[model samples]
Target: MKTLQIVFIALMTIFTLNAEATEYHVSVNGNDNNKGTAAEPFKTISAAAKIARAGDIITVHDGIYRERVNPIYGGANHLNRIVYQAAPGEKVTIKGSEIITNWKKEKGSVWKVVIPNSFFKAYNPYSDVLMGDWFNKKGMDHHTGEVFINGKSLYEKSNLNDVIESKPYEEALDQEASTHTWYSEVDANNTTIYANFQKFNPNKELVEINARESCFYPDQPGINYITVRGFTMNQAATQWSAPTAEQVGLIGTHWSKGWIIENNIVSNSKSVGITLGKDRSTGHNVWMYNPKKGGATHYNEVVFKALQIGWSKEIIGSHIVRNNVIFDCEQAGIVGSLGGIFSEISNNHIYDIWTKRIFRGAEIAGLKFHAPIDMLIKNNQIHNTGRGIWLDWMTQGTRVTGNLIYDNTTDDIHVEVNHGPYLVDNNIFLSELAIRDWSQGGAYAHNLIAGKIEVRHSTGRNTAYFLPHSTKVAGVSEIYCGDNRFFNNIFIKDENGEESEQEKENQSYGLHGYKIAKYANISSGNSYLNGAKPQEGETNFVEKTNLKPTIKITKKDHHVFLEMDLDPSIFNVSTSIITTELLGATFISEAVFENPDGTPYVLDTDFLGNERDKNKPSPGPFENLKKGLTLYNVGK
Candidate 1:
């Protein structure tokens, strides 16, 4: 009986080993030749990625990995996703920068570094200037390469003389800093970078250069079902990514599907931080303007072939970029074109985008996306940026809710050239210009708009929309900024629970269109108080009432936005304008509009993830401005 029991136990142990998933470990002290175990781990993540299969977990210890990690394969299914995670509570840094210890002092506080051409090997970003489809060269040379000192990126000077002759870096307002300026000159066999680092010893501090093009990206296409989490990824020599060009980001999901990149710190990217975009081919007719290099057919032939090959769900992208802290990018924190279909980007803190004018382009924002069909962007705090969010082109069936946006230099949210059925709800817009509507058919409800609003009639602008949930071209449609609605909102300029002096002086009448034409728009059930005046002549706003609900915002946290407490019962007064009416474009019904995946969605929860009473919900992103109702609030 004992022998029989031992045999059965051995058989059960073998079966359990077969069913269990593998865990691979990586540490700095390990070697690639060693077995990927906890004691004998691999040296690099690239080595682990080469052998990692479905249901494998790569556990990297606390250290800085200088090399880029290119995932060759994703999992066969979501359940078998390959996860790459930093050890719990460990600081794992995956950087695209290489420390240069070969610097020779040129003069007082000026240094020069000569890198052999073999150092870069296949690709040299210093020689590669920024000029591509939809990219304006502006008759000047611009490289994707960057130089960093101690962590912050230094300015790239046009010439060596500019850095050498310049005085102490000027703290000019709204201008790019010239401190620690650098210039690069590339020859056939070497690339030399000269920098002026006044008062700082280059030999003592960590001076790094943007050596790699991307920090974490797969080379080949269709690498899906992967998760990159809990690491600090930074300092890539990423170039300007236009929809027409081969779009590359610091960490981009390139024309793939089902990727989740969460809980990582992405920063100091040269152009863009994260890209869930198409893999460069001829997109729409956006290349016609830059005809000197190539015509429209020449630039877009690859896209035409791609379309013929079928731009469907199996080929396009649907990625989840959530719970990330992405900042310090020149162009955009997150930018996507056409590849953001059926994706969810939630609980990400994206800020400090496009604050530096060192790189100039029309494409600059905190979060800019093109053709985000049925994508959800929620519970994000975007502040201190140029443009908060720019949803351009075919933005059908998309929902932007539970987001707190404020202090943007330009318009907080710009919805351009989209047709209809998109929903924008429960957002806090506090800035100079809130919503810039070039094309309409969006439903705006339960929002707190504390800024100016503008509308542009773009009936002649021809755009495209995709089939719901797929990238197949639905049809070509012109921009018709009509049949829009705004309801159950709170527009105010109260400083301290009452009208500010600016509101009393009629400075709050900051809503207007170009006034060339008016469309069928509805604006009602909105409480505009604290001396804020209703927009005139165009919108069908309900009669304005002067009632100020108490707004409580405390600066408890230092980095991101503060928490607010505004009890919903405070607005439950006798003169309240609350109702159960459907907000926004009423014509956007089942017959005309459905979700991209043909599924239906209801905004049943507030920004704090609390259930909302659909019959009479309060205004703004909170169901109740109770304390502790933050993005991380778990309905306590």
Candidate 2:
């Protein structure tokens, strides 16, 4: 009975170990011959990722790993989703080595310059003393200003004196060194000093950087959905070659999708930190052509309407991008212009964007929607950029609401050739200026615009343009400039305090309109309050004299009618009168007349002529009339 109980316990222990998920441990000091368990671990992350399967987690132990590890090739298998995570209370740092090389010493130079390794411990005051102590205990001199590693220099020649002065080598050997801690000056020089180190965790600071060519993958489509989390990648500035047709940080392909990059710090790269390819057709015609149509002669000119749904048919909708922090890149951060739809970009802080010499402009918006449909850009803070939000041609049904934009060098929100009904509401634009050309159909309501809103015509100058002539028709028009109810909007000119009475009087005489009508809503608070009063004009009437008959009416039963055509050009005409009269006579039937060309005209009686004599008749029996006229003439 005792032996059976012991056997049951042994079986239970083995089953518990087998049921647990696989955990591959990685450490800088581990040996290659050891297993990837915690007790026996591998040294490099590249090796650990090679043997990991899907749903497997790679636990990285604390230490600075001074080599680059490519995780893309091993991460290509769909069943092998690799996760590189750090252990609790342990910081796994992947950075450059901190040794000096290429020493050139000359007389009267005041100091010798040497290039340091990418990740040197001398940048931090606390870590510098430890590094100095390690060198001093090895019988090396403490007066040396710098150290070289792998034939590369770390500190500049001008910074050698500051580096020597800031060293705590002598104080580190004293008995009172434990009570005092050193702090460096915070300035641009300090930023440059920190830039030399590949990674620096200044007690409470989070360090993130990326090395060039550290991640590699083949150009294929089956390798989708790669995720990277909780890492600081320090990329060398001059090491990264220009991006070819087949290269990227997370995944390398001309066309690839379903990548998840989050919770990582990346900096200092040539092309981009995270890039998704938009241009295909480099190496093979297979990926270039549409595969679902069974090789039906793919033409590059044919563009697909929806890319995200066509690329990954398993997902019922488009993908989601959220919760990422990207900073200090060579190009626009998070550029996904590869024909995607229904994507959400929220809660991301993208700033400090720099451009190359070839490209002219820079962009640092929290979210940029470039020709995307059914997109939502909300609840983001974008500031100190070139342009806050930019929309190019054919952007439809996009809702830009609840965003706070300020302090940008250019416009806050810019849109062009957009046919969709944009709902721009509740957006607070504080100290922002926008110069937009045209808007066909949209609603700009409930927005708190503190600055000037300038809408100009695209084809002409900055003067106010009129609405088109065809807007008064009965069909549905594209522009709905109604219900936009502006209330409590204040406009302060430059001469608000110093406004003269003469300038006020000149402004009171408003603009004249001949072919177009104008609507002026001047408030009581304006300076032109008592300039012009509204007046009603007098209506003139006319009596017609000579009328023309349409046909010769000789029979007694035939009805005789007089048709008189009055001229409206003789009246005092104005735009307000014309607009009111045209609107009032839209439904009257008998007063309407049509010209020979079938165009409608109005019969106003202001210009008809009167007859000279009313007693004259045509071909009357004139014997009694002539005798009366003769007697009257003789008596007179």
Best by TM-score: 1
lDDT scores for all predictions? 0.73, 0.35
User: At residue 451, what lDDT does model 2 achieve?
Assistant: 34
Please state every model's RMSD to the true fold in angstroms.
6.5, 28.6
Which 10-residue window of candidate 2 scores lowest in summed lDDT? 521-530
Off by over 4 Å in 2: 1-21, 31-34, 61-82, 86-222, 234-255, 277-279, 282-320, 355-376, 391-401, 416-418, 421-427, 434-448, 451-636
**How many residue pairs in model 2 have overlapping backbones?**
20
| Alpha-carbon deviation at 168 in model 2, angstroms | 32
lDDT (Cα, tens digit) per residue for candidate 1, span 143-185: 8888888998777778888778754434322343556688999
**What's the TM for model 1?**
0.85
Q: Estimate TM-scores for all models.
A: 0.85, 0.45
* Tens digits of per-residue lDDT for model 2, 272-311: 4444433343312332233463221221111232232243
